[model samples]
Target: MNIQGHAALVTGGGSGLGEATARELARLGAKVAVLDLNLENAQRVAADIGGVAVQCNVSDPDSMQAAIQQAAAAHGPARILMQIAGIGTAKRVVGKDGNAAPLDDFARVININLIGTYNAARLFAAACAKLEPMEDGERGVMVFTASVAAYDGQVGQQAYSASKAGVVGMTLPMARDLAQHGIRVCTIAPGLFMTPLMRTLPEPVQQSLAASIPFPSRLGKPEEFAQLATHIVTNTHLNGETIRLDGALRMAPR
Candidate 1:
């Protein structure tokens, strides 16, 4: 389970937590592949990290398969997978105008956040299962991203929360299924973090959000998340668990 000198794949590596993870893995001596929907951003991170950039749509079968193949072609088959690519939306089941929320919104979020996660994991696990086992019969490890909203969703977050909750739900079962292949699966349900999307909010709004955390009363850092993710890879005994990276912050209903 040592990360050094192994091949790793990070989806959504263009920005935010995924970018931080890609850099950290590279720094730790893993040959990293940065996979993202934005080729430009992926390339930027890949170049800086001396890794390969792949344009990937995790929800698309062909795109995800091609991306895995391309990364293997460059870095060899990856034993580490970081499933971070996802989208979010906030919509009430019934809008202010008295119309039911568009079904497309809910479907889109589920497709990207939930189904997309499974798509990437299945392809990665299939390939990793073929690799020779490392120490302790471990061939690979994968970390999935979820959110605190999955546990306590605010108003108008039906789609976003459901999608993330699905990820949280999948963790233990997926781990159990892959255990036979010497592959481990875990999830991280992060609280508020200073991601690109969060940065778009007004400063005052951001400050208010930060103050909501019970202690340390500030948004979580991307590097912190990355650190935990890398730790999960090295700690062989940890598997089938969902670690919450929230700073003791149970979100209030909005």
Candidate 2:
């Protein structure tokens, strides 16, 4: 469906891939709502893209419902919902200190990464479903972010990998359920991208991660992920698939 003049909502729009997607959608003339837990960064991106800023905790049903309502009031119901808000925590189930990771810590990762994505997707898609389908017989599309670790998890990534894997596992069935309404569902399992989380590492660490990539021997760019998202939005045939944007780099055991 043509997204021009349509409303779009991107969670985690404050930084990294989410921010890039929001900017790209706005560039395409879509009114974007930058929903994020970080209000400061959300407002920054929102103002920069001439979009709305919504402070949201995606795991909370109330937060997501209220955010969608406010965004719709301002820009109309979101026809495109990008579930990019996530947290990556690295901790072994059994640490070197011989202490097991707290259950709360593990649950926190699941709450933000997996459950959060579902929360926002449900809210956004429900709203879109109520609206009329587009000229191309499409009501909306949802793009979720997962990590390559979801498939091949490295050491110290039990929680993070499991959460992301959940996101991947849900894509097909979710798409099937939403298909009757002409809404598409898909996932992007990104490899060592140059997102804010990666940038936080030391330069030497960044280089080590870059060198780990098979071909280009570099980190992926946010815009590259944005490219995939844009194509998924416009191409109606592409659905119920998870595209890996890792430049041929299958993650190794850390």
Candidate 3:
């Protein structure tokens, strides 16, 4: 699918990977909608990219419905959807808190990461399906973000791992389902990247995490992730697969 003049929606567009992707898409002639939980930050990124900003709670169906409608209003319909709105979990499923880690929290991670991805994908596909097919009979494509933890989650990542795993599980099925409509789906499992999620760590701690990588031995730049995402959007052959963005380093259990 050509990104030029396409309507693109990027969840978690406020910072990190999503923001970088949005910027890249905008630079490539796509009109982007920056959707995030943080209204101010979303607005800032949208302003910077000359796109619309939408405040969306991806975990909530109602919120996503309204936001998707708004995106349609602002930029026609989003034929390119990037699912990056997700939360990180550090608590165990059963913790030392006597009671097990709250089930709601665990469910929430699934809701935001997995269900949220579904919400955006469904909405984007529905809108795209209404449009005429492109040169290759491609209606649209969606790119989702997962984590390496889905495969090798450390001790405290039970909830996070489970949720991201669900994302991985869905990629192939989703692509098959959307095939008739000429839509495609793919997932990206990123390794240690310098995203806003990890920015909370101390600078030294951040360095340590980067140093742990094997070959490149450094954290991934957000722009690097964006570059891959851009390639996926532009390439019609890539679909129904999960690509790892980690730099040849497997994670050690924490």
Candidate 4:
């Protein structure tokens, strides 16, 4: 579907992949809404792109509804929904000391990453379902964010891995479920990307992580992620698949 003049909503748009996507969509002439937990960052990006910024908590239904309503009020119902809001907490299910991991930590990750994606996607689909179809009965598109850990989880990543794995697990079913509604669903499992979270680590650690990749030997850029997202939105045939953005890297068990 053509993105020009369409309403698009991007979660976690304050920074990283979501920020890059919002910029790209705006460049393509889409009316974009930047949603993030950090209102200041969201507002900054929104201002730069001439879009609306919504302070949103993807995990909370009411919060997401408010954010979506705010976006819709400004740009109309979002025909494109990009879910990038997620959190990672590193903790071993069984630590070296043999203590069991806290259940609340796992629940928190699941709530933010897995449930949050689902919550926003459902609302996006609901809103888009009401709109008239474009060509070939296509109404909308949804792109979700998953991590490489979902498939090859390392140590100290039980909660994070499980959360991402749920995202990966939902791709085909979601696509199938929404197919009747002329909505498409897909996922991107990014490898080591140089996101804001990654920037927090020491330079040496970052370099080590970069070197671990088989080729290109560097982290993926946020723009690269945005590029794929744009392609997914414009390309009509792509759906129900989880594409790995990793640079030929299969994460080793740490």
Which candidate leads the pack in lDDT?
Answer: 1
Which whole-number lDDT from 0 to 100 does residue 215 have in model 2?
78
Models, CA RMSD each: 0.6, 0.9, 1.2, 0.9
Q: Write the per-residue lDDT of candidate 4 for residues 1-254, one digit (tens) a residue.
A: 89999999999999999999999999999999999999999999999999999999999999999999999999988999999999988888788899998899999999999999999999888989998988989999999999999999998998899999999999999999999999999999999998999999999999999999998899999999999998999999999999999999999998
Candidate 2 residues lying further than 4 Å off, grouped into runs, are none
Superposition error at 238 for model 1 (Å): 0.7
How many pairs of residues collide in each model?
Answer: 0, 0, 0, 0
What lDDT does model 1 reach? Answer: 0.95
Model 2, 121-203: lDDT tens digits are 88888888888977678899999999899989999899999999999999999999999988999999999889887888999
Candidate 4: residue pairs that collide: none
For model 1, what is the error of residue 60's alpha carbon versus the real structure, in angstroms, after optimal superposition? 0.5
- Per-residue lDDT tens digits for candidate 1, residues 86-158, read 9878898998999999999999999999999999999999999999998999999999999999999999999
Spell out the clash pairs found in candidate 3.
none
- Candidate 3 residues 79-159, lDDT tens each? 898899899978866668666788788888888998888887887788788889997899899999999999999998988
Error of 2 at 196 (Å): 1.6
Cα-based RMSD of candidate 2 = 0.9
lDDT preference between candidates 2 and 4, better one = 4
lDDT of each: 0.95, 0.92, 0.90, 0.95
For candidate 2, what is the lDDT?
A: 0.92
lDDT score, candidate 2, position 143: 97
